[model samples]
Target: MIKYCIMILAFIVTGTTSAFAAETAVLQDAVTQTNINYVWTILAAILVFFMQAGFALLEAGFSRSKNAVNIIMKNFMDVGAGGLVFFAVGFALMFGTTAGGWIGTDGFFLTGIEGQDQTWTWAFFIFQAVFAATAATIVSGAVAERTKFTGYLVFSILITGVIYPVFGSWAWGGLFNGSGWLEGLGFIDFAGSTVVHSVGGWAALAGALVVGPRVGKYDDQGNPVHIPGHSLPFAALGVFILWFGWFGFNAGSTTVGDTSIALIAMNTFLAAGAGATFSMIVTWFQFGKPDAPMTINGVLAGLVGITAGCANLSPGFAIITGAIAGIIVVYASEWLETFVDDPVGAIAVHGVCGAWGTLAAGLFDTTAGLFGTQGFDPSIIGVQLLGIAAAFLWTFTVSYILFNIIKSTVGLRVNGELEAKGLDLHEHDNRAYPEFVGSDEFIEGEV
Candidate 1:
């Protein structure tokens, strides 16, 4: 009896120790994963933040040198303004408790979040905040050189604070806790092809239209004219910057530390490569030379095109999607020129390609696509179409109204005199390159 009691006591002690060990291991894993997620998210935010510099350079390069300072100012202001307004007002509208599946009604000023979620909230907000700024900046390129500084700032505030978040609520509100109608319908835009890119694209389209064509962009017969950018090298560098940043933009959407990042990164690379290659080939054949601007835009088009499906697409399909987007961007850029003066092809790269990417997700997603064992879910396609359509219409209409308001109240463009002389001198009272400010060749040719 004594021996048996001793054995039982030993078994109990061992079992308790084992349980304690298991609990400790689980807690350790949880802590480690949380730390890893925090690092990943912050890193991604930094990468996306770098895209601002890329936009500044690209806009400056595409625009005349006289407007370079103005371009830089606009890009800088948009980020500052976007970050603040998005934090104060946009985050709540997007991620708060849902109201009838359309909008968020709570969590304003990031109130009421506590404990575990609070740890996640800060890093996630910054990541998404950068994305909001990105959407706002896309319009800067489309309306470059002539948009009023004040008017542009106002639009940026409204877009990041109200316009972006409302739509974001409908699709991405569920990411944290609240559910959206589109999410209910099973819409999948893993990295926001429609949510970020398309919304920006459509808003850009509206701004470009309301702002009207730039001076000297059309002839007496309304024939299109070519106003060359200041520096192709700068433009190329900007494209490289944006390309590098996009890996973070797409892969980081995973928002966790996991093996999936490898696949996401590879898919993004393949798509960009295919896009650049196709654009080069098409431009060579169509224009009898590989156009530098077209090629750069092609790279961006691919990045935007794959964003929606990056998490879901196979690498081979990513290549196809990106290559098609590259070809489409060339044609879309040319086609849009006939109707509107888009200085930097923002409409093609973001708006048109954004729509295509979102829709392509429905077609190419392995789990829900025609290629899958389930053999094509029409409902997924329907949801994607509805989401894309809704984004385009909502953003364009709101943007048009907002632009008109800005136009009527404060004026949208600089006077023709200011535009011709350049925005740097008239708007900012400074020149980007002071040494060449008044040089004859600089004013007439470089400017």
Candidate 2:
């Protein structure tokens, strides 16, 4: 009897010890994963943050000499304003607890986000915040010479705080919480094709529509005029900066530093190179000269186009996708100029190419990709179409309403005299180059 009792006690002790060991192991794993996720998330956030510089240079280079300072200011203010607004409410609305499959409810002010597997959630918001800012800045270029600075600031806040987060919630937020229709439909936008680019593109379209054409941009006959930007070197440098940042823009969307990132980075590089190469060739063939601006825009268009499908496609497929995007950007920019006077090609690069990228995801996703691995149905093409339509309708309608409201109440455009005199002098009371001030000959002839 004594021997049997001893044996039973031993068994009980061993079982308890084993349970403790298992619990410790689970906790360790959770902690390690949390740390790893934090590091990767922060890194991606930094990369996306650097993209603001790329945007600043791009917009400054694209605008006329009279609007350089104004462009730079708009870019600077957008980052500041958008970042604050997004942190305050946008993050919650985008990634918080769900509502009726449309918006998020919980997480307001990032409250109670601790100890949760919120690494992905935080990183996603930061990266997406930069993209929202990018979209807002695109309109700055389109309305560079004409928009009121205060009015533009208000628009940026509304977009980042409400417009962008609302639509973004529909796609990524819904997917994160497992209630999104997109997941049920097997829709895959590994990054933000419709989420980021399309949202921005639609907003740009609305702003351009409301702001009207720049002075002398269209003749009385409605023919478009050529308003060349003042600085090609600046523009070229801006393109290079944007290209460099796009590595982070596309590859960083993976949100993790794993072997998959290697594939994504390779695909991104191939697409961008193919875009620039194809655009250069197309320009030489079609326009009788290799246009520098077209080449730059082509690269951007390709980058934007491939962003949706970067992780899903092979390098070769990326090249083809990017090349087509490059060609489309060239023609689309010209075509849009006829109807909407987007001075900086935002409509072409972000709008038209953004649509192409979202659709391309449906075409190029393969068995090796995320969709195939998950046994998601092949009806993703139709789902992608739905996402595109939803993005277009929601973004256009909301943005148009906001812009019209702003126009009727506060007015959207500056006076023509202020536009011709330049916003640096009239809006801010400072000149980017003070030496040239008070000289009409330099203002009229040199510019």
Candidate 3:
């Protein structure tokens, strides 16, 4: 009897210990996940911040050697000056509490937020600050080579501190403490296809229009004159760097460490692959050669195009979105050549493709899109269009007015003498390649 009692007591003790161990494991997992999320967010923000280097190299490569230093300076200032503006007023305007959902009202200089999670707040701030800088830097390429440095700086401040933040509040305000009108309406921009890219692109369009083309971008017959950059290799390297960094750009938007990131990263790369393939084919058929510039730009178009739907669409649909964007960029560039002199095709890759991506998010959504059982919801499509139209109107109008203001006040374009001598030498008293600048291959006369 004593032996029987002893065996029964042992079984009960073993079962209770097992259950206690299981409960402890669950709590440990919860704590571990929280730490993982913090680490992931910081790492992702770093990746996005590194993209400034890619932009600098890409813009410098597309421009003449004489303007390389100027391009680098613009990108350098984009991170430095733009970051300060975002810290002071831009972050508040984008993420602060507001009644109308039009702008943020608090959180300026990242103060008074100590009541919330301090670690999370600063991580989020740095991530978004880099994004604001990115939107400002896009204009540099569009208005390169001829824009006055002071004028560009002024525009950059306005964009980061006011213009980009307003639009960002409308779309991504809910990401922090604010709520956006567009987000309330269910606009789907997973990683800023419309909020960042289109806003930047439209602003770029205005700046390009106001700054005008380079000195000899066209002839008396109004035909585009080819002005090749000094180094294609530099441009290619920049593209690769941007591609690598984009994994964080899309996946990191989740603001968490989870399994969903695998899908987002996969979708990002697939779209890029499709974009490059389709762009090469189109360019090959049109030019009897696969043009490197268009092909590289096609990669960016795909990245911009899939950004809106990256989290919503299947892998197959991601490819379709990117492939279509690739085609659109080729024709868009050709169309712009006749009127707009976009030095790097920023407007087409970001603005037009951003609209397309936003629409694609609605069309390819897992539940309500065309591939879904209901075969796409017209309501979603309408909302997407509305958001796109709203972005264009708001950004273009403000940017156009701002650019005009700069033009009238501090001068937007450099003078003819500075143009011929190259901006590096005259504006900055600097030269990227002093040995190779004697050949001003493209600067003939003002357009």
Candidate 4:
């Protein structure tokens, strides 16, 4: 009897210990998942933050010698100004509490948020802050030569504080809390095609229009002039950096740590490569020569096109989308230049390609991916069109009003003589390369 009792006691104790161990293991796993998500979110934010450098370099390279420093300064200032504005007001308007699915009204200054989950909040803000700066910087390139430094600073504040945040609220502010009519209608932007890209693109269009074409960009007959950017090598470097940073821009949109990230990164690269290749071939065939600038823009077009559907589509579909974007960019650039006179192909790469990316989401979304696989919804397409239209009208109208106001008050364009001498010497009172005067660096050697 004693032996039997001992045996039973031992069995009970062992079973209890095993159960306790299993429960502990499950709890540990949950904690680990939370920590992993925190780390990934921070990492992705850092990557997107670095894209500012890419933009700085790209814009600086494309600008005229007189405006190089001004271009770099504009890019830098936008980040600083936009960051402060977004933190103070933009974040609240974008991701705060929902009000009739229009805008947010809480989370101002990132206040009252606590715990590890708050890391996700910070990540979202920083990533979006960088994007807002990007949109503002696009206008910098468009209004490059003549825009006053002080005026550009004010515009940056407006973009991050009001313009970008208002639109962003509609699409991503959680106002829908993930179930609003627009979200329910399946307006799957995945990333900001209309929200970020088109916002910037349209603002750029407005700035270009208000500022007018660059001096000598058009002849007496109104035909477009071909003024090459000062530095091809610098432009190429900028393109590569942007391509590298895009891995984070698109893949990071998953907003979570998962195996899906790998797939998203792959799709990003595939689309960019396909875009570059197709643009190279198309330029060679159409223009009778392979154009470098078009090829770089092709890469950007592909990246933009893939961004809206990167998480929702197959790699094959991504490649197709990118190639089409590449071709579209070539024609769009030509057409817009003829009609609107964009200086840097911003309208083509960001504006036209952004629309294509948004529309592509409706057509190419597959149900087999991690985000889910529901192919081609007509309703989604309609919603996307609405989103696109809303973005264009809102951005254009706001920007037009802002520019006209600035034009009337402070004047948008500089004096004709100041422009003729280049804004660099007249506005900034400095030369990009004073030491390179009469040197090989200043002369065109061999192309």
Best by TM-score: 1
Clashes of 2: 0
Q: Compose the digit string of candidate 2's lDDT tens values, residues 191-225.
A: 77678887888888988898888888899999999
Error of 2 at 232 (Å): 1.7
Clashes of each: 0, 0, 0, 3
lDDT of 1 at 254: 88
**Each model's C-alpha lDDT?**
0.88, 0.78, 0.89, 0.78
**For model 1, what is the C-alpha lDDT against the true structure?**
0.88
145 in model 4: Cα distance from truth in Å?
1.9
Name the 10 consecutive residues with the lowest summed lDDT in model 1.
438-447
Clash pairs, candidate 3, are none
Worst window of 10 by summed lDDT in candidate 2: 438-447
TM-score of every model? 0.97, 0.88, 0.94, 0.92
> Which is the winner by TM-score between candidate 3 and candidate 4?
3
Tell how far residue 174 is off in model 1, in angstroms: 0.6
Tens-digit lDDT track of model 3 for 1-447: 999999999999999999999999999999899788888888888888888888888888888888888899899888899999999999999998865989999899998753468778988998898889889888889999899999999999999999999999999998999999999999999998999899999999999998998988999999999888778888888888888888888998887999999888998899888888899899999999999999998999899999999998999999999999999999998898788888888999889998999999999998898777667688898889999999999999999999999999998998776886788876798778756645673343442
What's the ranking of the predictions by TM-score, best on top?
A: 1, 3, 4, 2
- Candidate achieving higher TM-score, 1 or 2: 1
Candidate 1, residue 57: lDDT: 89
